[model samples]
Target: MVDRKKSPKKTRNLEESRKEILEAAFWEIFTRSFQGVSVDDIVGKTSLTKGAFYHQFPTKLDLGYALVDEVIKPMTYSRWIDPLKEYENPIEGILAQLKNLIGKAKPSELRYGCPLNNLVQEMAPVDKGFKERLENALNYWIDGMEKELKRAKEGGYLKKDVNTRQAAHFVVMAHEGFYGMLKALDDPKAFDALYDSLKRYFATIRS
Candidate 1:
């Protein structure tokens, strides 16, 4: 008889458990922006018991931070900022990534919108904790992009007139506005048109 190996399910128990909680937490966030969501929604969605919820998150806010720390933060760097570091032509890489963002955004999401933006719009002004979290995420994104733009400028890829910080502001603001309009209209044509226009803007830079 051949010896059988045990599944490392035992070893992965905590990791798996954490992932489950985070996945449920992410869904809760996506479905319900900060002011409107509850811990019960997350707990009810998971297979684990209510005790499991407590073990992972003492309160819903803790879970919110975890979602940012575990999921959103890494993606912000990888999906938008850090990738530019590797490209021979960083501006093209950046523009391609912007197009990729729209491509990756689900039709439903385009109809409903970005969860983080939703949270910022709904909670930031009145809720200090939420404002801090939203600001942290937003700053991380803007700072990273600005860093890339600075790098591209130093390489003589962009116009001397291109202000990296201002460009970063314009990109983020335009992205938020595009998504907002996309959600309101439930149309990809608007997104495509705006993004194409942005691509043309990129083309106007020094070559």
Candidate 2:
């Protein structure tokens, strides 16, 4: 016998269960490399059974890909890409965004560094799927910065000679390098030097 009321509630419960599994899997993969973590590790963190886990994520690779597409991509876009639209001055916008990131950063965030970068470093070399997906996200970031810098150039904020493509590449590479170095050194003073170096480099492109 089909109970109509029970069906909707069961569906909600199923979705909620799947969300929990994904969230758990996200953190597990975030802290532990894709190759380092196991299906058992993810399942152990949740109350769900193996069948329930398999129902939501048929395989670990599927879950990893979902985490990259659904979890990481949206996050990178919102934090790193969206805010750039707000500033008339690309340099100011970039610096303001960096300051905001530095302000909100916690010890765990510092320790873990950037998730996109971490995954690219860990999984990109070994897995074709991971490499392509990660590169897509990275390209999105680079393209966004390049677009903003070109806008700035058109607005006469930057020198005509500036190469937006190379400048955009330098911005992302510097930001990632700063975070990785900070995490490695475990010193707050490292941020001051990083910021100073970035500002000095950015100075060269300004009109």
- For all candidates in order, the CA lDDT equals 0.76, 0.85
What tens digits encode model 1's per-residue C-alpha lDDT throughout 1-207?
633354466548767888998888777777766546677777788888878788878877777777776776666677777777788667877777767786567787677677667777876787677678778888888888888878888888889988889888777777777778888888877877888877787777644
Per-model TM against the reference = 0.83, 0.87
lDDT of 2 by residue, 4-111 (tens): 979999999998888888888888887877788899999899989988989988988888888888888888778876887888887888888887896357766788
Question: What residue pairs clash in candidate 1, if any at all?
Answer: none
Q: Clashes in model 2: which pairs?
A: none
What is the TM-score (0 to 1) of candidate 2?
0.87
